[model samples]
Target: MLAALALGVKDLVGSTGFSGEMLLGLIAAGYAGTDFIEGFMEKVPLPGAGAGAVAGPGSTGSGVAVLPDQSGNGAAAKVAAQMEANLASQLNAQTSQLQADIASLKSTAAAGSPETSWALLTGPSAASLTPDLVARLFVPATPRANIRTHLPNVLAGLRSCDLIDRDMLLMALATIRAETEGFVPIDEFVSPYNTDQVAFDKYEPGTSTAVKLGNIEPGDGARFKGRGFIQLTGRDNYTRIGSQIGVDLVGNPTLANDSILAGRILAQFLANNEDPIRIALADGNLKVARRLVNGGSHGFDRFKDAYDKGLRLIPEGVEI
Candidate 1:
């Protein structure tokens, strides 16, 4: 059917009276009609207005003439135009309402009468999440002193994954506190762990033999070799993660230590491992990540339990 139509168009264009430009216009109109014939009538509109207006090629005709049903044809175009205008008006009204709501929320947040925290966390309706709880969370943990040294990189890692959204990002940070009490391999917190060399050595290994036995290399080596966040341990895991993220984890383990790089890798791991996480979350796999990292009695719900505890410690208004 289309072939014959195309041949007819070709003949029409090849004819003497038809100019090149007219032929082009006819072909375009035919093409558009073809689309309309393929159950695309919804896009065709009523007759003459707005998006429905179909001028024959370059012709400036009002389209009422070109329409087969001229008398009622203009009505469809007018209707389509009115419908478009109505939709635009509704959208504008909705947008204004949403903006007003957002402004009101911002004002409420800025009021900072200690109730803001309560509203943000416990919902405006909840009774719990008292002011004291909020204070406990946001009052700062004596600065942890080491928080600045190690947390930024960890945050960078989370940000890289685009998982730095409020809920999960805070969850990850609180999980960090549960994991090592902010004792990153960085300078500030490195002192104590460094003192306990033997214990550290037992856990952090330098060689492939150490990795096989599930031991990590301590200090910068262990940290950069994949410690925090997703805990990208072992050469095998490194290779696998590297392949997955398009990063050379095997060649440059140091990238893991560089918060930004590490955060991205961790984010990739979490997002890509959604199915496993969903299953773990369903099965109450608190220690699902732990199992992935260390493979022990740790089950799912490990992170959830820690998060609950951390939430208790957190103050209102201050996000996790």
Candidate 2:
């Protein structure tokens, strides 16, 4: 009987992830005698019972009756409650110590591995990303249906560029949210905010912006205008990214709007400037990170919002 009681206590402590000294102590107490075990068990309050409540005949505190001890009489209730209080205190201390030990182990492992430390700060691998998890990364204003629809292509895009890290994935998602809150590739809006003229005359041949964009002909600005998840703008970008992805973006610039192609383009663009973006992010400079892709703080607010949301919602080092 004593051995069986000790084994039962061992199983209970083991199930709670409480081990080492606590387990040994409980087993040792159990081996002392069955009377000791019975006394300890009697003090453990029933589930949902008040801390001061004691089990006794005709009492419904725990929806069950516990016969009072033959000896000790009324004093049994007081003694039992006090013993329970003491046991609760001990259990709480054990739990806190176990949690601290687990945290220390995690910190030590992270210190031993820089990659693990990065993962701890950023999040888990992109391969483990799910639609439910992605939904949490966006604000309530963004439609859930849109996130569900585009999630497959988004994962594909990340995989295409070998962007397995959660941080990189968040950066890509944040950029998409900034550029197109609708979660669809779109043509750049013709406004003073986007262009100097409604006709996009600012990017006409011989102009400085036009020269930088490789827009040598008329209508080149509007033709090679921003499109895709990250706004693959300008003739030079279309030519360069298209060549890398094996698409004739220079001839059919609008193809950047295609869901699959757009995702690929977005990932490729980020991969191209990954170094500068990481540097800025490491310094907690979201503005510089956005500038690396957008050339300015065009969508800084949206970008920061999405990225910050991701950092909060996505659990570190936890695969979803």
Candidate 3:
């Protein structure tokens, strides 16, 4: 059936060239109509988004094939999402295999071991993220100061998760830097053990923000108020992120304060948000990026100011 479909598409497209893998993918994706397939092929065709991608390159504006989601759905969109997830699982499995293979290869190579070192495993970002860069990226006398000290470790966590591109790193920093107030506050705003209460100590379990963030019960408000650099708020978030990162964020909500763990969470969050965030970045729409991150235009001016300032600090030799 796939062979026949491929033949038909080929005949219909005439001069258009389609790869066997792509054709098989479209068939598997359950896409119908030659015209739809033709139009999709002409546009950015993302059959499977390639190996569980959280961060992607190219851009929708660039016509380099952005992963279509709610805005660009059909048989192709569904196919792409499924393909991405399946590919991601396959890639992780393949990553372990590749790591072992690289280990074997490194034994023969002059460098010794590539997989053992982050510089070898990570892309250009390994060199880009440094103390000096962090120093430059950080706003003068802001809260995100600790990020400079903790950057090397954060970069390592990013490398482990295979999210080490200039754009992605910058985007991550932009969003996180904005939310964490210069990376100053590792935990949420409200604290149960605080000796002195301030004006904005709003979280109290049944408050509006607290309820929206999934905080219930007596201490649930303070427990999952908002942790992590980007503020992973609410009980739902702690439980979900905990499961994703292999950390007991629910049981030990304080774990979100840990730099490396929090960094991982941040990377995951950025990775998962392809639409609007990555899509906006690809479109050169930084404002949209901020909007998507903030979930609205709230405090956008400050966020944009920080993002622009942060970009100046990225240094040369890297392209986001």
Candidate 4:
């Protein structure tokens, strides 16, 4: 399949070398065709849709084509309603996931400490996890001067989880500031990576198998592209992490978008493994984040700084 797609693409590129407007149209048409072939077409109503029978075209717009309600035959309007409800629920679930990811990112940025703050924030996100005592203690005060925009929610999440004490939280924040220049995205601090290390955060492996047959660049061939918060990269790491987490991490690369899930996976690896720690402690601690995110620890000494920084991010008097 990949081979076919690649060949088709190559031929398409070679045959036309089409420029500007025509190429744009072709790309758009191809995408639309792909969408139609997928299940997307099933859910989409024709333009200018309404509840019932198709009305004559008017200046306003075209009316939707409505099939007769199958309810009289046994499939009731209730069935359709139920399906609508189900779709709504699924959409809500997806929305919640998106919100959670956004909230997690915002909280992590605000809270400062990656480990304690994130653990604290996410644990209490669910109603079931909230403790009565902690809920009472949670003040509705405005966010402190040091905290960023989402500080309240982050603290709320922490309180809900009962993960850390106030003193510890402060310590975590300070640590975070020190490590990341205040929870900024890594890209702002680091340059584009030079090494072809394992793809971490958003790695997308190729779906079609035939990608390698013609003019195929292996790096561009869609195998184990890195992605996500910790940017878990490399084929070997993906395989191992997938096995450990009981998830098809490589198979379903999009799992990285699930922020809590991503964090859980990272915690499992970093908190559980010694090798990662050792790698982080090498290289005179020069390369910290790179080592952990890229697993440079496994084969090289490029992560000592990451370990030290992580430790420093821990608040005073709190032991790792």
Candidate 5:
């Protein structure tokens, strides 16, 4: 079916007027949201995207005429134009066919196709991610120096969540660093937000975001406020994430801040359903990743900066 679909799309492309220009834009844009398409798409190229145009018989790679313009006639220029036209036509045909094949593949796998298939990988060792490095990217306060102790947990979470990709790890680390204000691994605390104690007090029950997260109890705001490295928030979130990671975040909200569990929870959120964060990381779209994590771009610049620093520390192929 996929093969036939590609052939059919190719036929339509030949009959229709999809230009090379459109093909280039479509291919680039498609890379943003889809997977399994890039590998096949790599085989296709736009006129300029591919190597220089190759002239037909008796023409060189430069597409220069083998028969020189001995008479200073513009024969060479005409030959070059012909070569360009040929290359453009060739590239367009290939690109159109590949695009069709991609569409067919997407359709065939629609039932099981993931929003994005982030690469499954094994990243650097837990030892590789050091406390000093964490301090630099996230550097905790004098009292919070034990952040590195959770390295084992972070590694374990990566294995459980299968977020071994360097890019995915870096993205997760960056966000975790920012969300916890340098891996504090505790609940949010802001006296101003609540006349009482701690962070997330501003989120009373009935508030849209809180209500959406099912924080319906009288003290739900304080009880379920953002915790964990990624700052898991609200009663609904606590219950949901708790079930997945095998913890009792809903009952013992403080556990979300446990150095070890916090790391696991962060990884869990990244690899969870549709794995939007993983998808964003795969596309190198940190901005979108931030939006997915925070529902907005709050502190996104800080997140991106930390992620960049983490990238420098964690090199490629550092296994286990």
Candidate 6:
């Protein structure tokens, strides 16, 4: 045993490079026994020692390297936790900045987009008519109050009938300007051409005028007198137009005086004759266009004046 112990001491001293005093001490420990050698080894500091390692003999518990502890509450563990926290904070900050950047890009895109810019300029419907445009189209003597009161209904009528074309719109507007100078839907005056007793005798029941107008019933001429924006007249016209528009104009001809109904009646009438009117206007034949609507040149001058003014004022290819 003593021989083996001596050999182990020599090997330990040689491997550890212990000099003079340390080598002597190791030899003395080997002589003391295996237990003493083990105790001595436990007290000796090793390079790259792990955490929870016992302090070497004569160690000051400082300036010694240690591995990170697996257990909680150690210095190494605290440092690891602090590093993780810092990394998490930095990641969170970066994530927030990325989100903000994405939001700013979306906002910028929407603001600068062509569609959005056009929408802002043209409004929701891109309608051509405005109070300013209407005022400019009408003569100075035309009543502003009447235009304001009736223009909305007129626009609705034109739009409803799909009369958004520049020429069609001008023709309709001119018709209104000529038909009702005040832009009001009104009952016809007792003129010789309409309901005058002496002049309207030819329009009595069974007469040619009455037969032409389908005025088979007594008092039909007076009952179905000119009304609405276009002055819808005659029982035949009322029946046909009312059926086309799904209104009971034959039973209640007075409904035509309603501004909304009047506007619709006027637009529908124009739509019925749209083909010929468009052709005439295309050919610059205002007289034929006026005749198609009025059956004669009754309001040709006024219609021509209003149409010319509208062409000058309103831009071509304007949409509703």
Q: Give the alpha carbon lDDT tens digit for every residue of 1-320 in model 6.
A: 44324335444345436433333333433444554444434544344343345354333323443445546558665743564576566556654554444343334334533233233333435335665456545565778888889888887888889997888888878988778887889987777676445535556687777887788888787788789889898899999999988999999999999999998899899999999999999999999999998888997888987887676556677765
* Candidate topping TM-score: 2
CA shift at 131, candidate 1, in angstroms?
Answer: 18
Best by lDDT: 2
Candidate 3 clash pair list: 51-87, 51-88, 52-88, 143-182, 143-184, 144-182, 144-183, 167-320
Q: Which stretches of candidate 6 lie over 4 Å from their true place?
A: 1-128, 196-202
Error of 3 at 136 (Å): 2.2
Tens-digit lDDT track of model 4 for 1-320: 22224224443343436323224334434543454444333444445553343354331223223444445664435544665676567556655554454454444434433333334433533212222212212222412332343233334433433434433233223222333322221221222342234432122234232232121334432344444334444555566777776788667755743544454444444444434434533433434533443444331221232233334333333321
Tens-digit lDDT track for model 2 on 225-283?
A: 88989988789999999999999999999999999999899989989999998999889
RMSD of each: 22.5, 13.5, 26.4, 24.9, 16.6, 32.9
Q: TM-score each candidate.
A: 0.39, 0.62, 0.51, 0.30, 0.54, 0.58
Descending-lDDT candidate ranking: 2, 6, 5, 3, 1, 4
After superposition, the stretches of candidate 4 with alpha carbons farther than 4 Å from their true spots are 1-223, 275-320
lDDT of 3 at 217: 69
| Candidate 3 global TM-score | 0.51
Residue-level error in angstroms, candidate 4, position 239? 1.8
User: lDDT of model 3 at residue 135?
Assistant: 46
Writing each residue's lDDT as its tens digit, candidate 1 over 1-320 gives 33224335444333356443334434444454454454233333344443335454333233322232245667646655665676566556655554444444344334433333334434544433333332223223424555545556655665566664444544454444444443343211333422245423433566444566344434434433435445555556666777876888767765655556655655666666555655664565557744543444322244444455444344344422
Whole-model alpha-carbon lDDT for candidate 6: 0.70
| Candidate 2, pairs of clashing residues | none
lDDT on C-alpha atoms for all candidate structures: 0.47, 0.71, 0.58, 0.39, 0.63, 0.70
